[model samples]
Every structure is written in C-alpha cells, then in structure tokens.
Target: MRSLEIHGVDDLRVVERAQPEPGPGEVQIAVEWGGICGSDLAYWRHGVSGTATMRHPFVLGHEVSGRVSALGPGVDGFAVGLPVTVHPARTSGPLPERLAGRDNLHPDLTYLGSAARDPHTDGGFAERITVRAEQVVPLPDGLDTRRAVLAEPLGVAIHAVHRAGDVTGAHVLVSGCGPVGLLTILAVRAAGAARVSAVDLSPLARERALALGADVALDAAEQLGQDVTVAFEASGAPASLEAILRVVARAAVVVQAGNLPPAPVSVALGPIVSKEIDYRGTYRFVSEIEEAVELLARSELAEGVISHELDLADAGAAFTTAATDPHSSKVVLRLE
Candidate 1:
C-alpha cells in the first residue's frame, strides 16, 4: 500500500507501507477519493494546524470516501464493496458525554490526520486503510464517491447551521468563501434563509459562493451595508470576526464556525455588549454527517466544489494546489 506522510514543514513524501488488515469491529477500505482540507494545508505548509504541532510524521487527509474491501469479525450491517464515508473522530476513552451521543464533546477525542495527540493518528491519504465499522456510514445509492468525500467538511457546515438554531426566512451572512464557507452557504440556503450572502478575499471563491446559492458574494474589503439576522464566521482570521460583529443586526445570532488560532484575539466589545448578539462556538458534529450526505445527495452543491482531482502519487502537488490555488475549492486525491 502507498501512503502520503508529512514529515515536517514543506516535507511531504509518498511511501510504501504494509497493507492494514481489519481488526474486530473494524473494516478495511479501498480508499477511492480524499479531499485536502485547510487543516491539511496548514500542516503541510507549517507542520502544524492551529496549536497542534506535529510530533511525528503524520498522514494528511480526513475528508474521505471509499469502498469496503474487507470486514473484520463482529461487524454487521455492512458488506464488502459497499461505498461509504467515515467520521474521522474517535474517543480516547469512554466518557459519559460520548456514550450519551455527544462524542464531539469528549475531552480526549482524537481526529484522524491531526497532531493534537502525541503520537499522531494516521489518516486516509492512502491506498487502503482500516477504520472502526461504527465510524463508517454507507453512501446512498448513486452518490458518487467524488461528492461523497465532501461529507466531512459539509458536516462541519451542517453542524454550524445547527448551532445557529432557526435560520428560516432570516438574512444570513457567511464570512469567508472557502470550501467550508461555500458549503455553509448551501447549508444556510437549505435551512430556508431568506437571503444568503458571502464574503471572501478571493474573487474565485466569491464566484463559487454565488454559484452555490448565495444571493450575493462580496470581497472582504467591501463594506457590508445590510444588517443580517444571522452571521457565520467561517474564516479563522480575526478580521472576519470583527466584520461579522459590525454587520449583524442587534440581537442577531453569530456562529463562529472556523478554527481560530490558539492565541487570544482582541476585538471590539461594544457591539457584543450593547447589541446583545448571541455568540456561539461550534465544534465537530455528532450526527450531522448523515444530514450532510443527504443534503449533497439532493442538490448540485458538489458541481463547483471540487476543483481538482489528482492521483495519490501526486499528493505533494495536490497539497500545493490546494494551498496556493486561490480558485481551488476542494482538491481531491484519487487512490483507486
């Protein structure tokens, strides 16, 4: 089997590795496609994502879809050759919250392809990999693996909209038109927002945002004159947070959907205090992965979302395109 590993900043290599076998309650998947996420780009460019610095060489993919090649003992309700997408998170130990279906809240949760753990957990940027059967969700019939690979980041957008509560008939603003941001636009529109608008520094991203159903797309530099009832900050930049506060109506809801830096960020406090904006933070989803798959199954959301598809052997170039290409949305690596 071939694997893509990140040794350090700007150090990515494709190496051969022993094929993994499924363990009890696990399944081995022949990886079909995998999307390169922003976090993956961060790790490739700087050997870190937020504060999670790499402690060892790490695999660099989480948004993945594949077909089951083999199944281990004790796994049921799944068959070999079944197409599926995976939930990348796993709990380190049994926790009350995790057992109660709030696994994302578990303090010791490990997300694949992340360096948050000392010995980083390997990810799905490979020819084949094994994962717990419980983490795999079967793709709906006729759902292409290319679009199914988006379930991971689409789940993030779904979870953010879930945090926003009722968006029906409300004006919504999505600040930042990255993959997650563009998907957030689709999610918000599907949630029945009356008007959906987006902001991004990249014109290409803005254009894609509009194509994804945003009523209007604006550059981050432009002044936002209309006040929105709900705002989503999908860009981790501090400036995006500040901009949302300025454009949100009084008593509006603001969901911080992006992963911010570990350092404290200073922003104006008057609006939050006087306007009484409901500010919330959302983490990885619990059950929204299913919703993401369902949503993608119904719409053309995946049309422009995938910008490039490269072979697994070109993992380095794939990461470079994802990191530096302003027009690229989701860069997928085909393994099979």
Candidate 2:
C-alpha cells in the first residue's frame, strides 16, 4: 500500500508501505479521505508544529474517515464495511486530579500524526491503517466519508465553543475565517448565538464564512462597533488576537483556538485588565468528536468547507494547494 510520508521540510513523499492489520482490540480501516490540517502544513514546510519537531519520516494526517475493513479480537458492536471516523487520541497514562474527565489534557497522550513525542506516532494518510477499537468512532447514519472527514476539525470548533462558556443569544465574533474559523461559526450558531460575525484577511475566506451562516463577515482590520460577548481567535496572527482583546464587551469570554507562534509575540494586554475578560485557551478536543459527527450528519456545515479533493496519486498537489491557496479551505486526499 502507498502512504504519504514527511521526511523533512518540503520532503513529503508518496511511498509504498506494508499494509497494517488490526491488533487485539483494534480496528483496521480502508481510509477514504484525509483532510489536510494547518499542523500538517507546518510539518511539511518546517518539519515542526509548535514544538513537535519531526524526528523522522511519518504519515501526515489526523482528520480522516473511512470504512471499516476488519476488526480485531475483543472488538464488538462494529462490523466490516461500517463507516467510521476516529478520535485520534491514545491516552498512555493517568490524568491529573484537577483534569479528570478531560482526556485531551492528559499528560501522556499520543495522537495520530503527531510528532510531539519521540518515535512519533503515524497517521492515517494511507490506504489502510489500524487504530485501537476504543479510538474508532462509527459515523452517524447518512453521514458519508467526505463530511465525516471533517469531524476532527469540527470537534476542535465544538471544543472552542465549550471553552467560551455560554453563547446562547449572545453576539459572538470569530477572528479568522479559515476552515477552523468557519466551523466555529457553525458551532456558535448551532449553540444559539443570536449573531455570528466573522473576520478574515482573505476575501475568499470571508465570503465562505457568510455562506456558512455568519450574520456578517468583516475584514480582519475592522473592529466591531457593537459589543462582542464572546470572541474566538482562530487566526494565528498576533495582531488579530490583540484586535479581538480591544473590541469585546466587558466581562466577555475569549477563546484562543488558533496555533500562535511557538515563540513569544508582543501584544497589548490593557483591554484584558480594563474589561476583565475571561481569556481561555482550547486544545484539540475531548469527547466532542462524537457530537461533531452527529451535527455533521444532520447539517450541511462541512459541505462548503471542502474546497478541493485530490486522489492519493496527487498528494503533492493536495499539499501545495492547502499550503498556498487561501481560497482552498480543506484540501482532501482520497486514499481509497
């Protein structure tokens, strides 16, 4: 079987690899679609994401969906050919007392496609792969692999919404209209936020945010004249985060969902002191992926997010488009 692997910066290759089979309490899947994530681009361009430097060649995907091909011993409630997505997290140890029930915050977590740890974990950007049965999630009925492929990112959006506290009927601002930001708009709207405003530097991103049900899409440089009760910083740009701090209403909730630079960048903090905003940070996700699947199965939220889909044979084009084209939201690779 052929798989996409990253050796170093600008060194992604499609190479032949032995097909993996399921182990005890595992599930083997024939991957159909793999969504290119910001982290993937980081690994491809700089051999690192945040501080997770690439140690060697490894598969490059976490957002993926496919059909079950085989189930290992002790696996139940799943059958061959069942549509599925995965949580992509494998907890290696116990959680802290204060962080109980939040598996995403586990100190010893191994996520698929992450180079965070030594002997980095491989991902599902291949024709076939196996994951522990516990991580495999059956897709909701009527949800195809194309949309289910977005469950991971949608989970990030949902988790960000949760971090922002209650947004029901409140004015929310999403600072960035990339794939994650657009999905954040869907999540906030679904959570009953009365108005959803999005901001992005890219015209294509701004336009797509509106198409996905944002009440209004603004340029990143503009400030919202009205009060923003909750704001999500989805652009990694430090300026965007600073601008958000300046405009939110007093005592508002601000969730940082985007990946800021690994190194420190200066930003104004006066607004936080004056307004007493609840500035919070959100990581990948928790058990929200199940909720994301249910939501995607019911709505067209992820439909407009897929701007391009290429076959595994054209993986380079897929990565190039995802890295260079701001207009392309989600660049998917059809592995099957």
Candidate 3:
C-alpha cells in the first residue's frame, strides 16, 4: 500500500508501506478519496498546526472515504465493499463523569493525522488501512466516496453552527470563506438563517461563499455595518477576528471555528466587552458526522466545495495546489 507522509516543512512524499489488516473489533478499508485540509497545509508549509508540530513522519489525512475490504473478528453488520467514512477521533481513555455526552471535550483525546501527542496518531491517507470498526461510518444514500470526502469538515462546520445557538431568521456573517467557511454557509443556510453573508480576502473564497448559498460575499477589508445578528469566524486569521468583532450587532453570538496560532497575537478587545458578544470557541465535532453525511446525501451543497481531485501518486501536486492555489477548495486525492 502507498501513503502520503510529511517529513517536515515543505517535505511531503508518497511512499509505499505494508498493507494493514483488520484486528479484532476493527475493519480494513481500501481508501478511495481523501480531502486535504487547511491543517494539512499548515503542517506541510509551517511544520505546525496550532501547537502540534511535526516531529515525525506520519500519514497526513483524516477527511477520507473508502470501502470496507475486510472485517476483523467481532465486527458484524458490515459487508465487504461497503462504502464508508471515518469519524477520525477516539477518546484517549474513558471519559470523566462530568463529560459523559460531551466527549468532544474529553480531557484526553486522539485525532487522526494530529501530532499533538508523541508517537502521533497516524491518519488515513494510505491505500489500505485498518481502524476500529466504531470509527467507520457507512455512507448514506445519494452520497458516494468522492463527495463523502467532505463528511469530516462539514461536521466541523455543523458543530460550529451548533455552538452559535439559534440562527433561525437571523442575519449571519461568516468571515473567511475557506472550505470550512463555505461549508459553514451551507450549515447556517440549512439551519434556517434568513440571510447569509460572507467575507474573505480571497476572491476565490468569496465566489465559493456565494455559490454555497450565501446571500452576499464581501471583501474582508471592506467596512461592515452592524446588522448581522450572528457571526462565525472560520478564516483562522487574527485580523479577521478583530474585524468580525467590529461588525456584528451588540449581544450577537460569535462562534470561532478556525484554529488560531498558539502564539499570542494582538486583537482589539473593546467591542467584545462593550457589546456583550457571546464569543464561543468550538473544537471538533461530537458525532455530527452522522448529520453531515445525511445532509450530503440529500443536497448538492458539498459538491461545489470540491474543486479538484488529483491522484494519490500526485500527492506533491495535490499539496502544492492545496497550499498555494487560492482558487482551489477541498483538493481531494484519489487514493484508489
């Protein structure tokens, strides 16, 4: 089997590795498609994402879709060749009593493709890889592996919206129209937001934002009036965060879904205090992949986000386009 691994900053390689078989309570998947995320680009370009620095070579993907090729002992109800996507996360240990249903906030957690822990958790970019059966999610009707590659990121978008509380009939602004921000537009639109608007420094992102059902797409540097009732900061840009605070109406809810740098950056603070904005921070999804899968199966919202599909052998070109091409969003590698 072959996998895409990152050795260090600007060092992404496609190398062959041994094929993995399913273990007890696990399943083996023949990977079909995988999406390159902003974090993946971060790890490649800067050797870091948040505080997780790339200290060792590891497979670099989590937004993946594939078909079950083998099922290990004790795994039932799934047949060979069943299409699936993975949840990409597992509790590092038993959740504490206080965090029972809120497993996303567990004190200890491991996410695929992350280097937060030493002996970093390997991801699902290989041609065939084995994982716990519970991590596999069957594809819903009307969705296939290519489009299903978006399941994970869309789940993040949905969870971010979930953190925003009630958006029904409210005017919402999504700052930074990257793949996640575009998907956030879809999530908010589906959640009954009356009018969705987006802001981004990239013209490509703004175009994607409008294509994903946002009512208007504005340049990030433009002056924004305080009419939005809700706002989501998905750009991960510190400057955008400062601007978002100045634009949203007083008492509006703000959800920060983008991962900011670990180092401190200057941000204006007066509006947050004077306006009493409910600035909430959201991490990864807590089982919202199920809903994201359902949404993908029913609508074509995700299809527009996938702008390129390159073969796994072309991982270099894939990562390059994903990192440097502002016109491209959700660059997927065809693993099969």
Candidate 4:
C-alpha cells in the first residue's frame, strides 16, 4: 500500500508501506476520499501547529470518508463494504471524561495529522488505514462521498452555532470564508439566522460565501457597523478576535471556533466589560454529528460548499492548490 509521510515542514512524500491490519476492536478502511484542511496547510507552511511541530514523520489527513475493507477481532455489528466517515480522535483509553460524551476534553486527546500526538498515529491519506470502531460513522444511502467527506468540518460549524445559543433572527458574522467558515454560513442560515455576513481577504471566497447564502460578504479589514449580534471567528487570524469584538453589537456573543495559536490582540475592554459579551470556545464535533449528517443528507442541492476533487495520489497538489488558491473551497482527495 501507498502512504504519505511528512518528513519536515512543507515536505510530503508518497512512499510504499505495508498494509495495516486492524487490531482488536478496530476496523480497516479502504479510504475513498479525504479533505485537505486549513490546519494541514498551516502545518506545512509554518512547520508547527499551535504548540507542536513536525518532530517526527507524521501522516497528514483527518477529513476522510471511506469503506470498511476489514474488521478486526471484537469488532462486530458492521459489514464490509459499508461507506463511512472517519472521526479522527486518538483518545482511546477507557474514558472518565469522554465516555459520557464529552470526548472533546479528554486529557489524552490527540488529533489525527496533528503534532499533538504521544504515539503518533497515521491518518487516511493512503490506500488503507485502521481505526477504532467507535471512530467510524456509517454514511446513509444516497449521500455522496463529497458530502460524507464534509462530516468532519461541518460538525465544527454545527458546534459553533450551538455555542452561539439561539441564532433565530440574530445577526451573525462569520470571519473567514474557507470551507469551515462557508459551512458555518450554511449552518447558521439553516438554523434560521435572519441576517448573516461573511468576511475574508479573498474576493473569490467572499463571492462563494454570498453564493452559499451569506447575506453580505465583506473584506475582513473593512469597517463593520454595529449590527452583528453574534460573531464567529473562523479565520484563525489573530486579529479576527479583536475584529469580532469591534463589530458586534452590545451584548453580542463571540464564539472563537478557529484553531488559532496563541497570539496577543488588543480588545476594547469597555465593550467586553460594559456590554457583557459572551465569549466562548469551541473545538471539533460534539453531540452534533448526527444532526450535521442529517442536514447534509436532506438538503435538496449540493449546498455549494465542496469545490473540487482530486485523486488521492494528487494529495500534495490538492494541498498546494488549497493553500495558494483563494478560490478553493473544500479540496477533497477522491479515492475509489
């Protein structure tokens, strides 16, 4: 089987490797499609993510959907050839926190393709890979691989919206028009937000956001009036946090959903103190996977988010294009 190994910053190599066999309580998936994420681009460009860097050879994919090729011992109640989406979490220890469904806070949680691993596990940018049975969610019939590939990031959007409390008739602003940001737009719209706006540096991104139901798409640097009731900082840009504070209406909520490494930013203390803004943090999918999947499956159209598909062998090109091309939305690497 073929696998991708990250040797260093901005480096990826396709190499021959032994096919993995599923261990007990695990399943092997013949990867069908994997989505290149913004965090992957950050790791390649900066050589580090958050507080961790590429110290050892690492695999670089998390947004994935595949088919079950083999089942390991103790893994039952599932058939081979079933299409499924991969939930890339490595907190496999018998849970104290996550077992109750709050897996996001599991202390040993190591994300797929991230530098935050202890015994770093490989990801789904290859011919096949093995994962715990609980990490795979079976995709419903009639949902295309592209939509299944979206299950990971759209789940983030869903989590952020839920953190915003009630979006009904609320003025919402999404900072960043990347795949997750655009999907956040769609999610907020679907949740009945009366007014929604998006911000990005890319004109192409702004256009895509508008096409996908964003009421207004503006440049992040533009002056935002005091109308936004809730602001989602999804750009991962350091300044977007302060921007959210500056533009939001009094008593508005700000959900920092972007994976921003720690950086200092000036905030208007008066607004945060006087208006009592609810600033919250959100991570990956939590209790919203089923709803996000159902929404995607029930939508009448493609929802205008997934932009392109490339072969798994061209995963490097997909990352390059997604990192450099502002027009790129979700660049999915299609397998079988």
Candidate 5:
C-alpha cells in the first residue's frame, strides 16, 4: 500500500508501506477519498498547526471516507464493502470530562493525522489503514463515498451551531465563506435560523455561499449594517472576530468556531460586558458526525463545495492547489 506522509516543512511524499491489519475491535478501511484540511496545509507549509510542531513524519489526512475491507475480532453490526466515514478522534483515561460524556474535552484527546502529540498518530491518506471500529460511522443508504468524505467537516459545523445555542428564527452571521464557514451556513439553516448572511474576501467563496442558501453574501470590508442575534466566527482572523463583535445585537451569542493562533489577540471588552453577550468556544464535535452525514445524504450539501479532485499519486500537487487556490473549496484526493 501507499501513504502520503509529511516529512518536514514543504516536504511531502508518496511512499510504499505495508498494508495494515485490524486489531481487536478495529476495522481495516480501503480509503477512497480524503479531503485536505486547513491544518493539513499548515503542517505542509510551516510544519506546524497552532502550537503543535511536527515531531516526525506522519500521515496527513483526517476528513476521509472509504469501504470496509476487513473487520477485527469481536466487531459486528458492520461488514465488508460497507461505506463509512471516520470520526477521527480518540481519547484515553477516564477523566471527569470523559465520564461526563464530553470526551472531546478530554485532556489526552488524539485527533487522527494531527501533530499535536509526540509520535503523531497515522491518518487515513493511504490505500489501506486500520482504525478502532468505534471511530467508523457507517454511511446511510444512497450516500456516496464522495459526499460522505465531507462528514468530518460538517461535524465541525454542526458542533459550532450547537455552540451558538438555539438559533431558531434568529438572524445569523457567518464571518467566513471557506468550506467550514459555508457549511456552517448550511448547518445553521438546518438548525432553523431565520436568515443567514456570509462574509468573505474571496468572491468565489461568497458566490458559493449565496448559492448554498446564504440570504446575502458580502465582502469582508463591507459593514453588515444590521444587528444579528447570533454570529459564528469561522475565518480564524482576529479582525473578523472583531467585526462580528461590533455588529451583533445586545445579548447575542458569538461562537468562535475557527482555529485561532496561539498568540494573544486584542478585543474590546465593552460590548461583552455591556450587552452581557454569551461568547463561547467550540471544539471538535461528539456525536455530530452522524448528523452531518444524514444532512449531506438528504441535500445537495456537497455541491459547489468540492472544487478539485486528484489521484492519490498527485498528493503534493493537491496540497499546493488547496493552499494557493482561494477560489477552491474542498480539495479531495482519490485513493481508490
């Protein structure tokens, strides 16, 4: 089998490797498609994501979908040839948070393909890989693998919506039109928002957001002109977060959904204190992966989102396109 590995900054390669076998309560997946995430780009361009630097070569993907090829001992309710998407998170130790059903808050959570830990765990950018059976979420009938591959990101969007808290009939602002931001718009709509407005510097992104049901799409420089009841900051830019904070109505909920830099960022405290706004942060999801897949399976959620697809052998070029192409949304590598 072949795998895509990141060795260092600006260094990526396709190398031959032995096919992995499933361990107890695990499953072997013949990966079909994997999406390159922003974190993956960070690792490729700077050899780091957030504060986590690459300690060694590791596989570079987490948003993926594939078919079951083999099942390990004691695994049931799944069989070979079934299509599935992975949850991508694993945690150990019985912490208070884990025991409370907030496993994502566990101190020792390991996200696949992440360089956050020493001896980084391998990801699913390979011809064959093994994962704990529990991490595998089976796809619903009629959902194709191509669309199922987006479940990971959609899970993130769903989690952000959950963080925003009861957006029903409220005017919502999404401060980015990237893949996650646009998907957040869709998720907000599905969560019953009255209206959604998207902001982005990229015209292509804005156009796509409008096509995906954003009531209005505006350039980042333009003022929103109206007070939103809820806002989601998905641009990962301090400036964007500031913009949202300035425009939202009093008592509005602001959910920080994007990954911000590790450094301190300046923000005015007057609005937060005066308005008594409910500002919150959302991490990766728990139990939202299934909801994401169900949403995608029922709608044209994948349309206009997947801008490019490449063969696994062209993984380097794929990463370059994803990093440099602002017009592009999701760049997926086909491994089958």
Candidate 6:
C-alpha cells in the first residue's frame, strides 16, 4: 500500500508501506476519493500549534470515501464491495461535550488525519485504510463514490446551519465561498432562509454560491446594506468577522466555522455585547453524518462541486492547489 506523510511544513512524501489489517469490529477499505480540507493545508504548512504536537511525519487527510475490500472479526451486517464514507470523529472515550450528545466537541478527540491520529497514513488518501466499523457509513445504491466523499464536509455544513438557529424567513449572510461556505449556502437555502448573501474574494466561488442557490454573492470587501438576521463566518479572515459584526442585526446569531490560525484574531466585541448577539463556534457534527448523506442523496450540490481530481501520488500538488487556487472549489485525491 502507498500513503502520503507530512514530515514538516510544505513537506509531503508519498511512500510505499505494508497494508494494514483490520482489528476486531473494523473494516479495511480501498479508498476511492479523499477531499482536501482547509485544516489539512494548515497542518501541512505550519505543522500543528507552533510545532509541538505535529512533530515530523504525520499523515493528513480526513474527508474520505471508499469501498469495503474486507471486514474484520465481529463486524457484521456490512459486507465487501459496499461503498462507504468514513466518519472522522472517534467518540469512544469520555468527554463532557460528547456525553451530552455533542460528540463534535469531544476535547481529546482526534480525526482520521492529524498530528494526533495520522489518518493520511490511516486516511482514504492512501490505497487502503482500516477503520472501526462504527466509522463507516454505507452509501446508498444511487450515490456515486465521488459524491459520497462529500458526506464528511456536508455534515460540517449541516452542523453550521444548526448553530445559526432559525434561518427561515431571515436574511442570511455567509462570509466565505469555499467548499464549506458554498455547502452552508445550500443548507441555508434548504432551511428556507428568505434570502442568502455569499461573500468571497474569488469570483468563481461567488458564482458557484449563486449557482448553488444564494440570492446574492458579494465580494468580502463589500458590506450588505441591510442587516442579516444570521451569519456564518466561513471566511476565517478577521475582516469577515468584523463585517459580520457590523452587518448582522441585533440579537442575530453568528456561527464561526472556519479555522483561523497562527494566532487568535482580534474582533470587535462591542456589537456582540451591546446587541446581545450570539457568537458561537461549530465543529464537525457526529450526529449529522446520516443526515448529510441523505441530503446529498437528495440534493444536487455534490454533482458539479468537485473541480479537480488528482492521483494519490500527486497529492502534494493537490494540497498546493487547494491552498493557492481560489478557483478550485473542491479537490479530491483518488487513492486507487
């Protein structure tokens, strides 16, 4: 088997290794596609948190989908040749947030590909990955593997929507048009928001957001004349956060979904304090995976969103493209 490893900032290595065997209650999957997530790029470039946890040589990739090549002992009801998506959340241990049904908030949790978990070695970015059977969600008969790969990110979008509370009949602003932002727009529209405004620096992203059902797509620099009742700050840019504070109506709910790293970004606290606005953070939701799968199966958002596909051997290029190419919405690595 072959897998990509991150030794340090901007260092991605593709190497050969022995295939992994599934433990009891696990399944070995032949990865078909792996989506390049923003966090993956961050880990690739800066390592993790000022270079401590992400000591050299970690596998990085989380958004993934594939087919079951084999199943381990104690695994039942699922079989070989079944298409599936891997749930990156490993919620087996105790966490106050997870026990309260917010597994996404599990403090000590590790995703498939990370400094702590190293799923790139264990990720679908490789030819094969062995995951707990509980992490595999069977794809429907009609869903293609490429689209099924989206179940992970779509869950993120759905979870963000859930945080923004009662979008129906309200004007909503999504302050980013990346994959997550675009999907958030779709979910917002699906949730019956009266109108949606998407903001991004990329014209291509703005266009895609509109095509995905946003009423308006604005440049990040521009301000919405009217106050939005709800806002999703998917941009991660501090400016976008400020814009949301400025444009969202009093008592509005603003959900921070993007990863703004390197340092804590500053924000204007007055709007939140004076208006009694709800400022919340959302992580990938564990419970919404099934719903995300169902929505993707029902909606057409997954049809044309994938803009690029690269072979696993060329995954380094995929990472670069994901980070620098504003035009590319979703880039997937074909492990096989």
Q: Compared with the true structure, what per-residue lDDT tens digits does model 4 show for residues 1-336?
A: 877777777788888889999999999999888888877777778877677766788787888887899999999977999888877876757668434776777777877788776556567778898988988788877776678888888888998999889999988999988888988988899999999989998888888889878888888734678888998989777777777787788899999888776676554556677778888888786657667777778773335777778886786788788888766788888767
Q: What is the lDDT of residue 225 in candidate 2?
A: 70
Question: Residue 163's C-alpha lDDT in candidate 2?
Answer: 87
After TM-score superposition, what is the CA distance of residue 254 in candidate 3 from its true location, in Å? 0.7
The reply for model 6, stretches above 4 Å from the true place, is 49-52, 97-99, 117-121, 220-222
The lDDT for every candidate, in the order shown, is 0.88, 0.91, 0.90, 0.81, 0.90, 0.82
Query: Across residues 1-336, which tens digit of lDDT does each residue of candidate 1 receive?
Result: 899999999999999999999999999999999999988998988777887899899787889998999999999899888999999988767778435866788888889899988899899998899999878989886687889999999999999999999999998999988888989999999999999989898888888998999998888623666569899999888888988887788999999998888889887767888899999999879879999888888987666789999998888889889888777889999999
lDDT of 5 by residue, 123-171 (tens): 8899998999999999998899998889999999999999888999999
Regions of model 4 farther than 4 Å from truth: 93-101, 220-225, 267-269, 300-303
Q: Per-candidate TM vs. native? A: 0.96, 0.98, 0.97, 0.92, 0.97, 0.93
RMSD score of candidate 3 (Å): 1.3
Total residue pair clashes for candidate 3: 0
lDDT computed for candidate 6: 0.82
Candidate 6 residue-wise lDDT, 1-336, digit = tens: 788887788888998878989989999999889999876887787776422357557566888888999999999988798999989877656868435877787866767876664332344568889998988999876787888888888889999999877788988899888888888888888888998999987888888989988898888634686568888999788888887888778898999988665577787879899888899989778678888888788887666578899998888889888888867889999887
**Candidates' RMSD to native:** 1.7, 1.0, 1.3, 2.3, 1.3, 2.2
Clashing pairs in 1: none
Looking at model 5, the pairs that clash are: none
Better of 1 and 6 by TM-score: 1
Give candidate 5 regions above 4 Å deviation: 97-99
Q: Model 3, which residues run further than 4 Å from truth?
A: 221-223
